[model samples]
Target: MWLKRFGGGCSREKLRSILETPDGELIIVGGKSHGNNQYKCTFEFYDDAWILKVDADNGAKIWEKTYGGRNYEHFEDIVKNPNGGYYAIGTACNKKNPPWGGDYCAKNKSALWMKFDDSGNSLGKKHFTNGPNQTGFSITNTSSGGTAWVGESKKLVGSKWQYKAIFYKLTGTKVNYSKVVDLGGWNATSIELTKDGGFIIAAGKNVFKTDSDMKIPALEK
Candidate 1:
């Protein structure tokens, strides 16, 4: 048995997802507290998303990088891109913090998707903002050679606000389709492409199945 840890310099870090490479390496993604890498003294780091690559044998570090915006931004899921590079999904906030009061910076947040190269260099990015609310919680590659992402979005209906499970797909920077599923939950944590050219998602206590276009049947909806 073996155990390892990282970010000893930071005050704290929270891991979100981990993926294994075909050649036996590991890709780990998470959020870390903001601070100087040389010293973990204060909270200036501002909560940013970070990725780390390590050897599968002894857990030795290969490379590490961080992605951040004006405020809170973090990765919730990651998936491999069929064309090349990798896709990462998370929540990005553009709001600035109050100088006197400690605000959560939850408002004005939107779903963020980014593409990175093999060495963790960013290539492109996209944001999905529906009614000014959506978070990127899960990502996967579809059968049509495009990337798909799912998450929870706060949508306003006729009178009241409702929580919606959002799904979207795109190739490169062009979005081909989008769908919203009422999964009776807060968010979808995982998703996978099925053999029948559909999608199977895990959300709350229910498993939702959808067609190629991400439309669920009446029985499943």
Candidate 2:
């Protein structure tokens, strides 16, 4: 067993996720604050989302990068794609002009997705925001060179604010299937592609399965 440290020089960095690449390297994703941002928070950086590739054997930094110009952006989940790129989901507070092509945000927070090549280059980005406090927590690879993410969406359900679990399937940055589950779970924290052509998701206190289209009975609540 070995332990290694990253981020230095008076900067505050917090790691959010890590994945092993096909080539046995490590891809670490998190947020970095160059020091002192809006909140005047001292313990951590909440300015930009950070990603880096490092040697798995000895933890030598190969490449490192930080995205999100100024607003608050933090990656909550990440997954390695079959086509050699990486997909990440952000629980972001990017209200205005985001890099992913979204213009309006009903609230201070929104859900985000971004793709990065093996060399850590931005490939594409997408955001899902229907109401207030939208957040995506997990991203997983499904069949057919596609990816999926699970998150929370706050919307009005019959004059009452409800927290819905949102599932989105993407085919190369294009949303092909989406489902808003109003099961009162608050947030979907994890997701996996099942072997039987289905999906399993874990939200606040709910676990359910859905077909490839994210439709049907939701198997079990």
Candidate 3:
């Protein structure tokens, strides 16, 4: 067996997800630290979202790219688009403003989506912020030639705050907020597309199925 090292010489680097291209190439998405090695005690760190393409057979690096602002950026999941490209979803903490343009810094830690061509060239990006602390955890290619993502975010309900599972459908940067299911303070970790074009969400100790519209249909403990 052969092993490969990426983002070498960095104080910290993490591989979050991997996807295989139609041409037998492997795409790795994660976060990597660069420049100063100084660490911080806060949640936001000095990191960037990193995408690496490698030869699947020989495990040799073909190309690598990084995207971020002055603060932190992370990629949690990736999927190949139907148009011979790739989409990566994650969270970003831009210091000045949100990448997609917003006035609040608390919304800086918003859901991020990036599109890249087959050659590892970036196409565009989109950011979503409903409330603070939104993070995209999983993404999948939808049957309608679009994409779907699932994450968790904090939202204010009446006088209290709660965490909710958020889902989104995207078509070329246009995001349709699918559903915001109240998680009762639990966290939504991942999502999968079912054969019937529905979705199965894994939240805390429960796994539930939702219809195509992201409406809860059933639950499994």
| TM-scores of the candidates in the order shown | 0.83, 0.81, 0.83
Q: What tens digits encode model 3's per-residue C-alpha lDDT throughout 71-118?
A: 678899998887788999998874554432233244447888999999
lDDT score at residue 29, model 1, on the 0-100 scale: 80
Which regions of candidate 1 fall more than 4 Å away from where they truly are? 8-12, 35-45, 96-102, 155-162, 219-221
**Model 2 segments beyond 4 Å from truth?**
8-12, 36-45, 97-106, 155-162, 218-221
| lDDT (tens digit, per residue) of candidate 2 on 135-155 | 888888876678888888886
Q: Among all windows of ten consecutive residues in candidate 3, which has the lowest summed lDDT?
A: 35-44
Error of 1 at 10 (Å): 4.6
Q: Top lDDT: which candidate number?
A: 3
Ranking by lDDT: 3, 2, 1
Instruction: Report the alpha-carbon TM-score of model 2 versus the true structure.
Output: 0.81
What value of lDDT does candidate 1 attain over all alpha carbons?
0.74
